[model samples]
Target chain A: MTTAAITVEGLRKRYGDVQAVDGVSLTVERGEFYGILGPNGAGKTTTLEITEGLRRPDEGTVRLLGESPFPRNPELLRRMGVQLQASAFFERLTAREQIRTFASLYGVPAERADAMLETVGLTEKAGTRENKLSGGQAQRLSIACALVHDPELVFLDEPTTGLDPQARRNLWDLLRAINDEGRTVVLTTHYMDEAETLCDRVAVMDHGRVLRVGAPSELVGELGAASLEDVFLQLTGREYRQ
Target chain B: MSAEAFTSLSKAMALGLLRDRTAAFFMLVFPLMFLVLFGALFKNDATARAEIVQVGRVEVFDSLPRDAREGLEEVLEIRRSDDRDEALEEVRAGDVDAVVWQEGDEVRLRYSAADRVRAGNARALVDSVVQQANIAATGQPPAYGLTTRQVEDESLKAIQFLTPGLLGWAVAMGAVFGSAFTLVNWRKKRILRRLWLAPVSAGTVIAARVGVSVALALVQTAVFLGVASVPYYGLELSGDWWLAVPLVVCGTLAFMSIGLVVGAWAKTEEAANGAAQVVILPMAFLSGAFFPLDMAPAWIQTVSGVFPLTYLNEAMQDVLSRGQSWGAALPVMGGLLLFAAVLTAVAARLFRWDDA
Candidate 1:
């Protein structure tokens, strides 16, 4: 099969005199863990939103499995899962009940919800209200809801922002497993260590434009740098904290 | 996909409603609030006695040889006063409900005619006593006849005149305030954004909200209507349960449109609550919530007429209390349609899918 799962050509976006995505273009190989690294407000979320069909670009063409990503085709939405940053649920609903509700939204079978709860390691705490869960548990529940339909492509925006080290490591393992299952995972994160470890390919973005793109080793080696953080700092004209 | 999809939407909305405890409380309170309110209206304050005063010596004053003094004392304290002006001033000041004055052959009753009914009752009691004493002593009927009258030109109460307004007030609140804040809460919680990303349409969202609100408004109407029909309010419900349908629908559309406008406009729960109340209280009070608008200022009436609740009250009164048919509420129907249309447009224009 042809390798690329998503193809973007000459993507551009502007917000009231500020260009958020400037002639950005890229391609993601099928079953690859594609990580986009950027600073805060570097238009990472904007680009992801456009790709997810939440926003339309001023100019460009996007092909997701060879179809437009939006008027938000139902067939396509069913195949792609999204995890928005700082997302939440009603406090009164249990984790199991919420997952079931989201499953219903996709017209999926009830057993799928149970399987997702099991997959996310929340089967024991499934009966607990989402608000009562620890941060890690809630994040796991969010992931469960997003993946209940077994989507092939996942968009995770800062999947580990509020996560502790243990939770983040748990999530990284989950992502690795998902990638191993021949799924395409597109994610954005500011954590350099996360980018170096989890990503199969990296796109270093600054000021809403990708300044560089390569394998982790290629990006690091091009700068004659010891770490991905130095390569990011050298290329983006900014420093990475820690 | 359509049938199964509809069921999924229905289930989601039901779950959403159940998830919000405050929404549940407001939903329940809409009906019960008016129940107690209308119950209090029909409650009898008549058990309390009214105060009045009797005065003057009558035409039979001379004939009551033995018992006239006692007869006068029994009707009132019978304070002896020479000044008619002073006694009339006290009556006008509302020191007592009414007063009486006696001339040589005719007895004159003096009190503010606005409260002339109390004056008439006091006059009757005094006349009967004086006439009994006359028959006992002179064995003759008094020459001047007794008459009864009232002090105030108007008599209004909470039940009959106000229940109609209360019914409208409750329905209006259910529609506008309920609708707006529900949307605001959904948006605030990012539920709308989540919903937008789903397969649901904007039209479906609006329709679902309408369905939920109409169901809520129905419960409120039933409770309020049942309480209002109790004998205390003198609600004379007739043979036409079918007649209320149009009013309920109109009220649902009118208020919910106001709500949609509010929900579309407000960014936060607090802003929505405040905006809804600002519209609600004036519509409740100024649109004859507690009393009739007939005696209120002409300008006030004219201004109140511009509110949808005013038309709602008039329509419901025509149907539930007065037993008029749906055809009779054409004025309300026309006004509500206009109000609903404009408010809906404004709200739709202002509706923001994002937090910004």
Candidate 2:
């Protein structure tokens, strides 16, 4: 049997006549760290959102671990974790309490909150309100909250977008450990370095379609480029800020 | 904690709100300031007869009908045969501050340059006396008819009338502020995204917020009403709060749901706050939180009924002042429920988790 964690075939969506996801298809193998790389408005988020069951695509089909991925089925939601591109929190709540509250939503024990806090190295700061946290600390707390239930699959969207270099490194390490534990992770990122280093396979998207999908080395090898950046530039043809 | 409890996400939300100090301060402390201020402002504890001259009482200056003015106890007016000469004599005698008489529709009034207070008092006294005369001539009281009699209900005190109003104000304020600020902040920070992606449903979030806001609002209502009605501190009840508290909670949910709608639809917390204030200010002012609704214009009464606050204010007045039951407040309470329903529907439809 095929062990693909996610399967998307011709997944499509439109927002007021803008074809946000145009005939895009890809497969993510189980236990693999997959990446979707694109710039703003490139449809990376829209594509990933459909896969996470947050949005219903106008056309196409999506299967997450052999189940249809829409309506956010409770069974699917229970086993999946997601860190949104912009993960807002209740500023008044202490980090630990916030995690505990979310855990209670899934009927997970409150003590699981403590374990996740420690994993994110925030046990010392667990009692602090989110508003009082330093930028890096707050982001880490958000990640801990998403991982509180220890789900089998996780989605990290622009996970390192606004983090400082040091915090970004800390996150990279944490992600590596999570992947090492054999959980499937699908992420979208603006940074090519982030994709190459953390991802096992990468899908570079442009204009609502996946232009290339392959192991990082194989994509570079095919382009005869020194790195993924060169391959990305060669494929997209516009080598500017985006 | 038991499965037998009705505790839902709403219970959790309420608990979370109670844990917040800022929410507590806005919900409880801010309104208490108004309570003390209005209480002191409205204090005629000394039987002081104070009157201010408002507009529209000037139409009766020249012609004084004998009957309406005949029964009145206090009428301060200036009688003069000459203009400048009469004005000079009045200024020296200090009997009345101003002289107002009409030559047709062009009513002329002159004031003493000496004392500002005396001038205003003199103006008000003239206005009232002339109004009384005008009414007497017509042989009618007012357009809608005026019925004036002493309320021998020795229990009707200023504080008694205000306590329930304060209770309603407190509950409504707390619920509205808490729900609005919390939802807006969550959207701004993207924390709502986590809930949208989690095993929890959006309904759970809405339920929790409503629960928390309603509970806190009810508590605030109880605290104020209890303090007022206690025998030692002046038992402010028409009866006990059994009927009042629940209706107040319903009103709280209604207002809180409106706040949530503002928060959910706004692009940011600041916008939500701004929108909430637009609604809250009118409710606070026009709903008779600071003064009696009877003091407002008739048109204001018409406008106020369109808001849940108008109903809540009316309900509080009935329960605490008139010692009425919840049945007396069904219309107003029903208005709040209607507002809550409409706001809930709109909020759910417009709520967005991501920046999109």
Against the true two-chain complex, what DockQ does each candidate achieve?
Answer: 0.40, 0.30
Query: Clashes in candidate 2: how many?
Result: 9
For model 2, state the Cα shift of residue B172 in Å: 2.8
What number of clashing residue pairs does each candidate have, in the order they appear?
Answer: 13, 9
Tell me the native contact fraction for each prediction. Answer: 0.24, 0.53
Off by over 4 Å in 1: A1-3, A88-92, A239-242, B1-27, B45-158, B230-234, B330-338
Model 2 TM-score on chain A: 0.95
* Model 2: residues with Cα > 4 Å off, grouped in runs: B1-23, B49-149, B227-235
The per-residue C-alpha lDDT of model 2 at residue A163 equals 86
Lowest summed-lDDT stretch of 10 residues in model 2 chain A?
A84-93
Per-residue CA lDDT of candidate 2, range B83-172, in tens?
555554655576545555556655556666577766776666665665666668798767765568665356676776677667677777
lDDT of 2 at A1: 89
